[model samples]
Target: MYISYKPLWHTLIERNMRKEDLRLAAGLTTNMIANMGKGKHISMETLTKICETLNCDISDVIELERE
Candidate 1:
């Protein structure tokens, strides 16, 4: 299985937010954002921060996929 952050990107676009904006708003580091861009897995704590910052749920950020 693989994890995808497609929904998160869509959400950001819908909110008119840039990656930098999300980093600042969610207190995430540049590395974290970069890793996500590369389809890397992040910690649940980080995910929670993103969800809270965006007023969204975990489902709005990531999804599991069969490879």
Candidate 2:
């Protein structure tokens, strides 16, 4: 299975927030944000922070792709 963060990007767009805004609001590092941009797996803790900051759920930010 593959993971994608496309949903998160869309969500951010819907909220009129930029990637840097998410980073600051969620207290995330540049590396972490970069990782998400590359569709890399991040820690559940990080996921929780993002979800909390965005007022969203894990499902809202990420999806799995079956291969």
What candidate 2 gets wrong by more than 4 Å, as runs, is: none
Question: Per-residue lDDT for 1-67 in model 1, tens only?
Answer: 9999999999999999999999999999999999999999999999999999999999989999899
Separate clash counts for every candidate: 0, 0
Best by lDDT: 1
Candidate 1 positional error at 65, Å: 1.2
Prediction 1 global C-alpha lDDT: 0.96
Cα lDDT for residue 38, model 1?
Answer: 99
- Give a tens-digit lDDT track for model 2, residues 1-67: 9999989999999999999999999999999999999888999999999999999988889999886
* RMSD (CA, Å), each prediction: 0.5, 0.7
Tell me each candidate's TM-score.
0.97, 0.95
Which pairs of residues have clashing backbones in candidate 1?
none
